[model samples]
Target: MVEPTGYDLLLKGGRVICPATGVDGIRDVGVRGGRIAAVADAILPTSAAQTVDVSGKLVLPGLIDTHGHIYQYVTGRFGLDPDMVGVRSGVTTVVDQGGPSCMTLPGFRHFIAERSETNVLCFLSAYLVGGLEGHFYPNLYSPDGVDIDATVRSAVANRDLVRGIKGHAEIGGFARWGIKVMEMAAEIARRAEIPLYVHFGQLWGLPESGANGEDADTILERVIPLLKEGDVLAHPFTRHPGGFVNAEGELHHVLQAAIDRGLTVDVGHGSHFSYRLAKMALAAGVVPHTLGADMHGYNTQVPEIPAPAGTPEEHADDENHPFKGQARFSLTQAMSSMMTLGLPLDYVVKMVTTHPAKMLGMEDSLGSLAVGRVADVSVLDDVRGRFVLRDNEDYRVIAERLLQPAFCLRAGKRFDADSPILPQAIAA
Candidate 1:
């Protein structure tokens, strides 16, 4: 028979990161009934059932990834199973961005949400067609794809799981009506009293040339008028046609204005969210309100696309090839990236935990480890010796130390350290 100790588990001798109160110190956490019952300077091992020595680790709230697409992209291609990538990465909660359209939400609710161990929330896509179809190709943007009425209705009906509305403004084929589509989506979100998350990148101009015309200023001009206080601007640092950087290599005024208005800016660091824009935006005083890996099928596997060497034949799939790099960055990597950008550890913790929880309107319920809050904790090891920080795809900086995960607790259940779902390699 399996041995059953008295209490559930105890994590002793770890530096705890409490973002809300800015508390980082050596502490012991006790878990009972699948919830954090106590956190203090020290707790006797005899007070609990199982005890794990986390002597040189960091304890924090289970990372909350506000933006991701686990269901949309399949692994080795674009998508990833949330439980495998998220929970094992020390993330207990994941907010899927535009994965399900208003029409296909029920499938997500039944097939994806109900079955996953990680807590999955969704931002309903304004497009009625949703992600079940292929990538947002030209044919996908037809009138039939966008059903504003249905989008609003679905959002209202599923307020619990559906948090916001999502729309994409890319340069390739759907650029012409990208701004208009996003505006319509934002209006619906406003009507439903929920935030609208817009993907601002490239916008297509006139149809004949098939070239991206509108710059970042033009793209922001269209959406700025429609943005509300809680609306989110996802991937604020994409380096395509219209991005945060101006032709003069300076931060645009509109980007600053959006931040000034309390609009939540997110770092949806997918394959295209290059370090250049991220570094510039951070320097421009636009701290990411939320940090998301934007993990999807295509981007996850071949995260960075190779530079065209006159033709496609020049490109070979080398493991070190930056373009063919896999979208395997964990939430921990996102935090560590911010740290590389000079963000304080406490502030980094807030971006993933408290700030994102607030943006999702779940601050009272999630994002913290205070008594009575859900027991979601991530324990990490502060690796003092082997710390090499990388920037963009090529740059690397040797640091004195790094923070990595030791273990994670979701609803008081102790999960293994090497689980594939959590981002523990950096922690390791």
Candidate 2:
């Protein structure tokens, strides 16, 4: 029998934190052949082909972003490069929410999933047309636009890539077709046997089609009952009308009921995140299950690589257009808001790892560092300083505990966190 040999790589002396494994302390993680070899208090350096000392840094399971947009080429100005928001940002797996529809799944698979160095999956859009231009033209997202038969067929055919269905239950669309659109989305989810990921807030761009229930407070009352267990309710902390927070600035009473029934609320923290509403939701016992950075061409603060040669800037001069890129944020930036709200580091990490992993049915492979599991890990730098942070509501707070990505290992391959989502990190 061949004697025990060295590992492919070893991360030594790091404060490894993985709530899924009940591990929290200094340890040495060994990886070989793209799988976790061992996680122990200490593994001699001689037993590894490569070893990197990670003292004082956080070594945890690779981060999983439950909601992200990276449809590039196809979406024109609304998409971003997958790796730009994935490995480059310290995230190993990113779920592309609403970027691909029945008609565009082929392009998504050939262009994104097959090409990205980072693992990319999808929550197939409810509309047959998908999130073209990130839903800039709301009429395309109308109930009449959703082809239930085609959407269900596409989702079933792409089960490996399609984990759930994406839809919007906002006042804009609701005002036009009432709850019919949401019902169609739920029917598609039911047919596919996958969860429906519903985004809340104002997504309608057309003129109001008369009050078919425009009051934001009454949104949950209509949609929550329609949602089956495991469905995701995104953007609970949105400052916009027709979200979790009511017009009176209080948590909608039905929010808790949905949570109790197994409805997962994801923090698809976008340009609409409101620290003020977040406080109210927390006080009312609402907590985010997944921290998703709804990063896209419009909300991303990175330098615009601009449209290709002849692509027109439909709303280039319109500052408020949803596709106009602006704030500089990433998955880590979105989670900072949660940490600033007083969540412990260990559990906050779980929200992005274990919780979403299970929701996507990828728990066995993606969220843990257990022996024989895929060797994907994230190294974070927990910095302490009085840093001023702001929310989409213009509210600001000074945070003493900030978590930043140092680097990550995807299937045992080292990828440094060099994303320009924040100030450059001091060399460690």
> Per-residue alpha-carbon lDDT of model 2 for 1-428, expressed as tens digits?
99466799999999988888899999999999998999999999999999998898889899999988899867665578998889988999999999899999999999999998898999999987787753446677777788999999999989899999999988777777778989999999999999999999876543545555467679888899999999999998887888898888877888888899999999998777888888888888898898888887667654255444422366444454444444456787677768889877877899889999988988878889998898889888888877767765558876776678888888999888887554332221
lDDT of 1 by residue, 341-404 (tens): 7888888888888988888888887888886677888877666654554433544455455665
- CA lDDT, every model vs. true structure: 0.71, 0.83
Q: How many backbone clashes does candidate 1 have?
A: 25
Candidate 2 Cα misplacement greater than 4 A, ranges: 206-213, 302-314, 318-326, 421-428
For each candidate, give its TM-score against the true structure: 0.86, 0.94
Write down the lDDT that model 1 would get. 0.71
